[model samples]
Target: MLLTIIYIIAITAEAMTGALSAGRRSMDWFGVILIACVTALGGGSVRDVLLGHYPLGWVKHPEYLVLTCCAALFTILIANWMRHLRSIFLLLDALGLIGFTIIGCQIAIQMGHGFVVSAVAGIMTGVSGGILRDILCNDVPLVFRRELYASISFVSVICYWLCIHFGLTLEWTVVTTLVFGFSLRVIAIYFGLEMPKFIYQDDDEQSASSKDI
Candidate 1:
C-alpha cells in the first residue's frame, strides 16, 4: 500500500516535470502529453521488457496512465505558477527517485534476483524516465550529468538490500531506504556534489587517426 501510494506520487511528479520540459521546448499539448506519459512510465516499461516481466505497469493498471495524463494537463494549467515552486518540485523529484528505486529493487528481489541485478533495476527505474524526458526535450540527459542522481539510486539499492539481509521488516526497509536516499539526494543538490566527469579530449594523434578513418 505504501509503495503503491509512492508510485502514484512518483509518476505524477515525473509527468509534471516532463510536461514542463515540453513547455520549455514550446511543444503543443499533444507533445506535452506524449512526453509526460513516456517520462512517467518509460523506465518501468523498459525494466519489465528487459526482465521479461509480463504486462507492464501502465498496461496492467490503466489508471496510472490516466493519472499521468491528468498530471500533465494539470501542469500545463499551472505552468505560470511553477517557477515559484521550483524547490518543491526538486524535493518531489528527489522523493520520486528514491521511491522508484525502492520499488524496482523490491520487485527484483521478489523475483529472486541477486544484489547486482536488483541494483541495476533500481538505478534504471530511478533515472531512465528523466533520460527519456530529456531526450524528448532535446536536452542532455540529467542522469548522466546531475549531481549524484544515479549513484544515489545505486546506493539506495544497496541500502535496501542490506536492510533486508539484516532481517529488517519490509516496511522499515522501505522507509529507511526512502529516507536515506532522499536525504542524500537533497544534500547532493544543496552542496552541488557531483561525480567527476571523464573528459576525453582527442589528442593530436587520436584526432589524426580519426581523420584517416
Candidate 2:
C-alpha cells in the first residue's frame, strides 16, 4: 500500500547515493550494483533475520533487487552531476533513515513485540545498511561515528510508540514520525552534531602500571 510505495522511494534514493559512494572508489559496474544493493536492502534483510521474520522482502519480491541495481546503473550515468547535488542526496538519505525506522517499528509492532524490541528493530533498520556499505567500501561505519543518525532513529521509534499509545491513527503516526525524525536528522547533519568519541590510548598498560604504584 502507501507504506510499500514509500519504501520503494526510500530504497531508490538510498541506492543512488550508494552508487555515488561506489563512484568514489571507482568500482566496476558489478561493484556499483553490489554496494547499492547492500545499502538499499541490507538493513531490512538483517532486521528480518534478527526478528525471525522469514521470507525476506527482497527474497519474496525479487523485483526490489532489480530496482536497486537499475537505480545504481542510472546513478552511474549521472555521477558527475551528483557531486553538485550532495545536499539533495543528504536529504534523501535522511528520508531513507526515517522511512526505514518507521517500517521496522511497524513490522515489529505487527508481530506483537514490546516497545524495547520495536525500538531495537527501528535502530537496526536505520543503521545496518550504512554499516554494510561501509564495511564493503572499507570505510568506517558512518553510524558508529557520524552525526546523530542512529540516535535519531531510536528517538523516532519512541515517538511513534507514544503516538500509538495516545490513540493516534496510522496516518498521524506516519506523518509525525516522518516530519519529526527527518527534521532532527537533517538538522544534526547540518550542524555536524555528534556524540562524544571514545579515543583509545596506546598507553593503557603504562597507565595501569602507574595506578598500581
Candidate 3:
C-alpha cells in the first residue's frame, strides 16, 4: 500500500516535469505521453526485474495505467506553469529518490537479500527511471552528472540496512531512511555539493617560454 502511494506520487511528479520539458521542446502529444510513461515506469521495471518480480508492478495492476494517464492529463492542463515547475523540480526529484530507495530496500530485504545487495537495489531503484526519462527526453541523466545525488541514495540505503540490522521495525526503518535520504539530497542541492574532477597543469611552461626567447 505504501509502495503504491509512492509510485503514484513519483509518477505524477515525473509526469509534470516531463510535460514541461516536452512542451518546452514543442513535442507532440505522443512525445509527451511517451516521456511521461517512461519516466513513470522505467525505474520500477528495472528494479522488479532485478528482484525477479515477473509481469512487474504496472502489469499486475493495471490501475497504474489509469493513474499515469491521469497524471499526463494534469500535466498537459498545467503546462503553462513551467517556471514554477522548474522551481520545484529538485524538491520533487529528491522526494522521489528517497521514497523509491526506501521502498526498494524494503522489498529486497523482504525477499531475503543481504544489506549490500539491498542497498545496490535501492540505488538502482532511485536513479534508473530518471535516467530513462532523460534518455527519452534527449537530456543527460542527472545521476551521471557530478552532483552528489545518487551517492545520497547509497548513503540512505546503507543507513536503512543498519537500522534493519539492529532489529528496527520495517515502518520505522523506512521512515528514518526516507528522512535521511531526502535531507541529504536537500543539503547537497542547497550547498552545491559535488564529486571531485580531474585537474591538469602545464608541466613544461618555463622551458617552453625560454626556448621561445
Which lDDT values do the candidates have, in the order given? 0.91, 0.91, 0.78
The worst-scoring run of ten residues by lDDT in candidate 3 lies at 200-209
What is the per-residue lDDT of model 3 for residues 48-150, given as tens digits with 9 covering 90 to 100?
9988968887898878766766777778887677566674877877888888888777778788898888888888888887788778767887677757978
lDDT of model 2 at residue 101? 94
Clashing pairs in 1: none
| Model 2 misplaced regions, further than 4 Å | 204-213
* Each prediction's number of clashing residue pairs: 0, 0, 0
Candidate 3 overall Cα lDDT vs. reference?
A: 0.78
**Candidate 1 wrongly placed segments (more than 4 Å):** 208-213
Best-performing candidate as measured by TM-score: 1
What TM-score does model 1 achieve against the real structure?
0.96
Candidate 3 residue 103 C-alpha distance from true site, Å: 1.4
Could you give the C-alpha RMSD of every candidate to the true structure, in order shown? 1.5, 3.0, 5.7
Q: Please give the lDDT score for candidate 1.
A: 0.91
